[model samples]
Target: MEGQATLNRRNFIRLSALTGGGLVLGFNYFLSSCTTEQGSGQAFDLNAFVRIDTNGKVTIMSPNPEIGQGVKTSLPMLVAEELDVDWKNVQVEQAGLDTEKYSRQVAGGSGSVRESWESFRQVGATARQMLINAAAAAWAVSPGECTTENGMVVHKTNGKKMSYGKLVESASTLEVPKDVKVKSEGSFRLIGQRIPNIDNHAIVTGQYKYGIDTKREGMLYATIIRPPAFGMTLESFDDSEAKKSAGVSQVLRIENKIAVLGRSTWEVMQAAKKIKAQWKDDGTLESSADMTQKLHELLAKAPKDKPRRKDGNIAQAFASAAKVVELDFDAPFLAHNTMEPMNFFAHVKADGAELHGPIQLPERARKRIAELLKLPEEKISVMMTRMGGGFGRRLMTDFVEEAALVSREAGNIPVNVIWSREDDMTGGFYRPMYSYKYKAAIDKDNKLIAWHHHSAGVGGSASPDSFPAGAVAHYQVDTHSYETPVSTAPWRGPTHNYIAFSEQSFMDEIAHQTGKDPVALRLELLEQAKNNPAGKVNYEPDRFAAVIRKAAEISGWGKPKAANIFQGFAAHFSFASYVAQVAEVEKQADGKVKLKKMYCVVDCGTVVNPSGAETQVEGSIIDGIGHAMYAELTLTKGKPDQTNFHAYRMIRMSEAPEVEIHFIDSKAAPTGLGEPALPPAGAALANAVFAASGVRLKNQPFIKSGLFA
Candidate 1:
């Protein structure tokens, strides 16, 4: 708090004396959270992610993108919790892309907390051990006799205490502890407690700086004019007229698009519109109808290759079953529609490049920028800004690439590239349109004998190990993919977002056909998976069952309710977490269904920052429900028909239902909370609508299905 902390080496940890005595700690690991795998067994380097001053002030670097998922706050709590420091004395800063310093810095798939749980704790625990060692040396006592509490080292016998600040000088001279004990779950103070987001005040008071707010000296605003359609290639462009526009500083062509730079966003946008461009269709223009037909054809035929997962003889089971239920579910392409449109600021000097903006994958962006500028990876530095909203859009570095390209093309002038809402919506990288064909065979006793699922989509498919695979005795999963010019990427829960709706709704249909309760049916399947798993199970059946059971009990699953109100239930496992949701709907006087309330139960292991955890669950539910009810993105001749929010149709504030969230108490390591709750929301809502009315919804954008229209 009273001295400056500095890094002594490029990628090594060293503690040296400061003017007033400051402490800095560096941590490095090969753990990648992008997937379910743990450490890569690769060599590690040191990078400073924690710094403390002699005044007892602490600063921690949050190495993941915020994306409104609360990682900006919750991640730091992990370090502070292990350091035994007061939350009031801790401040968090966003870390940039540093391969030597951090791993899995990208924020997607809800892996931020899960992947860092142990490594971040080690950082604090190791530091705390050093401080205690220093205190014991000063007192001439055993290190084990000293403990830490609220940034202070205490001796139990004499009841003497010294602030961690006082031990900094001595700690700097001590050897690093290879293994330091971490606090038990029962001893955690800040983890389970309800702590507000670190940036709550700044976010609410209009003081937060999102990527769109990025500013630098002599930075020119820019916009791009891309081909109107996905399959169209730029043939020619005339920007002479655009160059005459006021404030239009420069106009240049970059690859397939033309960039217009000016003093203001409005001027650049207006000048970009004045450019005359010619696009030539490459005989690959795709329409929504084409994609739909392709999916239908693919789903209709069995693949020639082996199935992704096959447990038993599915054909024989279906032929011998008493009854077979078959259905098809469809979900259209969806755009991210982040509040702050894609924007990035880039300064590409002759020797190195500096990029500042909202990017979910900063390391990936840095690597690409280095390649584009023909510089070494170390020559490129990326600064991640607080994002307005990610939901997986910022994971693509197209905007960042555009800014860097424009900057370099404009003679190394710092430039900020901004996308209009229309541009953001029309730009590719949407949630791929998906279709699921499910068939279930039921025996005479109403027991499921077999399950068969076929999924077809444009550049996507269902998980082979997803639920019901290990529950049913005979099961098979086959996926078919079709190539398209339109680009697609992960959106929130990715495949689970649409697959959960289809899977859970079909389960509901099975219950309705067999005259059994829906909740009871799921429990029965979970029990089978837990006790006698039929195949490889990727999730904890017991933990999954816990959330399902808890949600049922809290929502009064089988109990009586008020008239005109119907309830539905759904559960899913994703991102190493489990979530079960119950939706309540009211039948209006005119017979239309309205979402009344939502009850969600989640088990992401130990909860860090309960307030932020609740916020994530609530936001996921609203987002899932909003998209299922109203959001839609369609393409006509490879061009998006909906270019802005008006045509895209987001959920209105008044339409958001009341939400009640419950988290199961657990000692398990914290998992992901950002996405698990979202996958089940659409399914729960659709099932609720069916109970309110005898309608079975199969398509997404329920409003278009005429149930709520």
Candidate 2:
């Protein structure tokens, strides 16, 4: 199955003449096993991701979904950089779902850039070499004698030049090189440069089309009424009044939800409210409080444990310690409230099906929709539109599946299923609530001697081998999980987001208890891991220390500050990247804690598109701080208490702090930047709050418990 999903180019390039006597170049990759050509009567199979026209215009297809991550611009930049084409002459188009031609066409886990860097650069380098080969032949010179610059190949000796368009026809006849040399890091012109997003004008001018802005001819709108709580069954419904409502077209049922279709979205939403549905749910539903209590009970009972890592005798180390410190931490469930609520458009027919929306996992959606419709994968087409935000929520295909099911039941008519803000907020699939217990011991010499952590949560504990695990001489990690009906999935950095808070905060507590600087303590642990490691350390200690040192230097970690201001520090490694943060917090006279600024250091190997990297870092910090300070979801009887933005507060502009991000200089293989910066922000802020107020916040949403008051 994995081999079938891989992308391979089977056919060579095909050249044709355009209507204006311009040359058109097409490269095709076979989608099926038989290697048959697609329509248009082309003899060779073609999957054109890059096309050069006679008019000196280059069009590149961005193979990943653009979920407000600047991938649409950054991915194409990789191709254009290697193609040696002028950025101005390039046009970027979003590719439809084509797993056969493009591998991993999704946009979650910050893998878009990391996964596509090599293949995309290779694509451009191969094309550039071909164009240079054509120019070298025309100039009666060796390929090495010719060089490319700004979309033109020039012979340095004679200064003879030819545009890429002029060589397309000749290049098409040549064989695709199996191995071409891509430019080295030092030779990169566009890769590291700060290029403006290609869609900036369209976005600022209100011309960009998001999922909500998509429209089709004769398309109907729909709104689904789901059960208020999980495990509820649709017992009965009365849609007679909804059918008579204004502009109401049809009232139907699909799966466990009832749908109201109308000519406009407003009409459908209004009609949905009028339809009365009777749901039958078991009375033994659990709430957030109940779940939290259950987790505590499980922890106290010492339920069956899955030991992740164990080193020396922890009991002996603790028993020989001078002092021991223990603490309990709890974090509530969270909701992914994307600005644009979950919406999708689908049209299913006996022959084929089409789906369009802001889906992060298009390939997965296509396969699932194919199975749901009882059709082959090739019979379905999925397209992605610009999304307001994804944050891992769009990774799920439930909304797309619902849209397809509704479209099929609605006489195969094109239908756009829209979820109101309330619907989206109250929907299932949330960040699972978690509870953690941490204990540490210090020896007579004030050296860390023992460490133990036990965690319990809905989806299981986050990565158990958290940082400092391999650094300690005697370390052990145990986890217990409780199965619940509540749907749970990855949220942003997934496990790292919550785990960083618990681990980093506890490390800070250890620092305070040992009379050591928090940043210095982490540095010492990293040094210990590098020099004399206890077990197999998964992270690079040098790289980890580099970021911590850099963040401390930039933030003036030990410098004295104003009376009301204090600093806190934290560092973490996630998504194959290392990040460290120092937060400056101010405790207002009224006891509210305010973040004044933050200094961040990131080491994601090599940087791609510095501007985009910075934007991602800044955004992740704000998102992290927002959730840590004010965002949380509570349940009452297995139903979300927060309905929309009014109740589910986000970080306001006034509350946002200045963030300074600096990346370590390296030419190593680049990793992801989207998620690594976030995990540390929560810990850094919490530690800073403690420094400012002389209080330890063991629970999330610090404001909920009047910690700020």
Quote the lDDT for 565 in model 1.
90
- Tell how far residue 278 is off in model 2, in angstroms: 0.7
Instruction: For candidate 1, give the lDDT of residue 7.
Output: 21
1-709: candidate 1 lDDT, tens digit per residue: 1111222222223344445645454333322221212223322222334666778888787878888988889888988998899999998888787776577888898998898888777667777888898899999999989888999999999999999877776776677665566789999988899998889899899998888888898999999888888899999988899999999999999989999999999999999888999999999988987898999999888777679899988999999999999989888999999989999999999999999999999998998898888999899989898889888889998999999999999999999999999999997589989989999999988899899999899968888888887999999999988898998989999899999999999999999998989999998998999988988989888889999999999999889988889999999999999999999999888888889899999999999888999989999999999999988888999999999877999999999999999999999889999999999999999999999998999998899766773
Write down the TM-score for model 1.
0.95
TM-scores for all candidates: the values are 0.95, 0.96
Model 2 bad stretches (over 4 Å): 1-12, 27-47, 590-592, 705-709
Candidate 1, residue 487: the lDDT equals 88
> Could you give candidate 2's per-residue lDDT for residues 1-709 as a string of tens digits?
1111222333435565555777755543222233544444343323444778877898887778998889989888988998899999999888788766667887888887888777777767777888998998888889999999999999989899999999998886676666677789999999888988788899899999887777889789999999898767788899988999999999998988998888999999998888889998766567889999999997787636557778888889998999998999998889888888999999999989999999999989998998899999999989889888888889999999999999999999999999999998897478878999988989999989889888889875758567897799999888888887788878999889989998999999999999999988999999999999988788999999999999999998898878888899989988889999999888889987878999999999878789989999999999999999899999888788999889998999988899999999989878988888998898898899889777898898977757563
Root-mean-square deviation of every model = 5.1, 2.7
- How many clashing residue pairs are found in candidate 2? 2
On lDDT, the leading prediction is: 1
Cα deviation of 103, candidate 1, in Å: 1.4
